[model samples]
Target: MPTTTQLVISGQSKPGVMAQVASVLASAGVNIKAFSAPEVTGTGKLRLLVADLEGARAALRGAKIRFAEETALVLSLENKPGALNEVADLLTQARINIKCGYCTPSREGKRAIVVLTVSNTEKALSVLRDQSLDEF
Candidate 1:
């Protein structure tokens, strides 16, 4: 799987703020895979996982949404039960801790896509892949 970094933006915590930001990404044909609003004081923070980071950033800027960039590990995992636990264990054994993680299954039950913010994703991927487990 191809890995890409996501951009996070912050702005006033008000209605329509998220909507407008989403609208820009939608208009740009950038699929939003994952998103969230982790609060920073009274303002809201927008986290976006998109296919076209540059295009999404441009659109957000055009829409006047203050934003910043950060790196994240994006991966697909088995959709069955215990799959998540196995992945976490593999990372733990390798000493590559997970900073944060989120997952959503596709329409079918074949796979669950997971995005992980980890201390060392490169090492984690290497370890998991050696075990024939999915990490990317």
Candidate 2:
């Protein structure tokens, strides 16, 4: 099963803030698993997936950065065409609305890891799990 890990970078509300943050991660060779910017003002939030979450967090803090954290659902599905359509169909049928989602392929497989940010997390998890096709 895949697990979603959220890294909350201090708000980068100002333009160019995200670039600075991304530069730091890029310099560290951290692969971004998933990314999101909160709509809050002043402080910006960035959620990332790195090869090493602890190490990344430590590095950021060593640089005197602030961040928050959370666990999300990360699932991998077939990369073939229409794969997403199937998932969407299922969710729609279940009356689940996906607020946001991002996808990236695994380095070693023909599967894409999708991080879904939804309102009804627990219910979504249940539905996905019941389908025997998702891992969170």
* Number of the top-ranking candidate, with lDDT as the measure: 1
**Per-residue accuracy of model 1 over 113-133 as CA lDDT, tens digit each:** 887777876787677778876
Specify the highest-TM-score model's number: 1
* Model 2 C-alpha lDDT per residue in residues 1-118, reported as the tens digit of each score: 4556677676648888777777777777676656877677766567777777877787777666788776666878887899888877877888888876778888887888887766
lDDT of 2: 0.73
**lDDT comparing candidate 1 with the true structure:** 0.77
RMSD of 1: 2.5
- Predicted structure 2, TM vs. truth: 0.68
After TM-score superposition, the amount by which residue 41's alpha carbon in candidate 1 deviates from its true location, in angstroms, is: 7.0
